[model samples]
Target: MIDPTLPLIDLHRHLDGSVRLETILDLGRQHNLPLPAMDLEGMRPYVQVTDPRPGVMAFITKFKWMVGSLVNYDACQRVAYENVEDARQEGIDYLELRFSPGFMAEPHSLDLQGVVEAVVDGVKKGTLDAGIDVNLIGILSRTYGPLAAQQELNALLHCRENITALDLAGDEANYPGELFVEHFQRARDASWQITVHAGEAAGPESVWQAIR
Candidate 1:
């Protein structure tokens, strides 16, 4: 399992979902947010997956404290920057880090557009510090419903230049691709690459719908 000549590229990664636990505890304390645990070991079970999860939703629950720590724009930036550093430490030569501005903002009620800008800025700085090539992808979290997805899409579009692609994630079974056809169309119109999470919790029909 040794291939030194080949390049290491990670095409699918969620920046919002890859937040550091230490940072979460740090930010949680700084903002006086009510975290389930105060120390690393105590907080691990809440913010991490120690046991097997039943489904996507159960697995997604681990993200609560991860995002809860994002209490401000600065916190968002720090998370993004750390993601890049982590990727570099893992020997990744290039990465595409995706994020949902709406999801990241909802915990703290931060401005959507501001979150995008801060993430872009943080990635830019991280690229320099880590000496690795990185690309940004904007995600529309379908768990928030169509109207709310529109607002999420708008925030992604606000920083369209900085983002290399658009992805549809969250509750694949409940929110099918049909609901986001228009949203991806707009993303395509913007000349961004399209990616989606389909058929994971749903049926083959979801994959066919994504293709259509």
Candidate 2:
């Protein structure tokens, strides 16, 4: 086994996925958010993979509850800050945290740009405090369709300094990367780095489409 004390690098950690469970409970309580359950064990199945899931959709559902906790700018910032802190605690030396600002803002109808800024601010503070290097990636959900993806891309472009890249995430088996080719092209035209989530939930064709 790798030594627990050794420093590591994490390139694909998701900000939403990395949120500490305790933090989610705290946010829910502070915001008076209507959660399915009030306790950690009670909320586990809703926010985590506790059962044997056969498909990607089942895996993706775990995010919905956690995403609901990010109801404000402060909530977003706290999640980002804690994400980095958790990585630091795990001995992660360099981390690239990715998240969909649109997803984080959707539950509360928060501004996408504000969400991005808050996450960036939190990451800056966390990295400083933890002595780790970190970068952020903005995600565009494939399931949200073309218009929403374009809007997300626009938001990401506007916060280029805070965001290091654009990532395509969501149901790859059903919503292929080809569906957002134009949007990805636009992101590339704006000199933004691009990464696509493919082949994990789909076959090689999904990867080919993302690359194409």
Candidate 3:
């Protein structure tokens, strides 16, 4: 599994989902948010998946603490910057970090547009500091339903030049790709590439819907 000559590219990593455990504990305490544990080892069981979860939704629950730690725009920026730094340390040549503004904003009621701006600024700084190439993909979290997804898309559109692609993620089985046809069309109109999280929690029909 050693390929020193070839470039290592990661196209499907989520910025919100890749937060370090130490940062989570630090942020939680900094904001006085209730954390299950004070130490890294104690925090692992709450944030990391030690055993197989019941289903995809159950697994998604683990992301609560990850995103929960993002209580403000500064925290959002820190996470994004750190993600690029992490990619560089992993010997990655390129990385695409995807995230949902609404999902990151909901728990703390942070401004959607502010979240996008912070991520863009953070990734830019990280790339410069780490000497790595990183692109951002804005995700429309479907679990929030079509209305909120629209808001999320609009916030992402505010920084269109900074984002390379548009993604649809969260609650695939309940929300489905069909609901986002127009959203992707808007993303295309803005000259953004489209990538959807399909068939992970749903069926082939979901994949077909994504393709269509």
| TM-scores for candidates 1 onward, in order | 0.97, 0.93, 0.97
Give the alpha carbon lDDT tens digit for every residue of 1-212 in model 2: 87877778999999987777788889889889888888889988888887799888788888887888888899899899999999988888999999997788888899988888899899999998999999888899888787888888787888787777889998787788878889878878877788998898889988888877
Listed per candidate, the RMSD to the true structure in angstroms reads 1.0, 1.7, 0.9
- Candidate number with greatest TM-score: 3
Residues 1-212 of candidate 3 have per-residue lDDT tens digits of 78699999998899998999989999998999898888999989887799989777888898999999999999999999999999999999999999999989988999999999999999999999999889899999999999899999999999999999999989988998888888999999999999898898998889888887
lDDT of 1 by residue, 184-207 (tens): 889999999988888889979888
Clashing pairs in 1: none
Clashing pairs in 2: none
Measured by TM-score, how close is model 2 to the native structure?
0.93
Candidate maximizing lDDT: 3
Decoy 1 TM-score against native: 0.97
Report clashes for each candidate as comma-separated counts: 0, 0, 0
RMSD of 2: 1.7
- Whichever of 1 and 3 has more TM-score, that candidate is 3
- lDDT against the true structure, per candidate, is 0.90, 0.86, 0.93
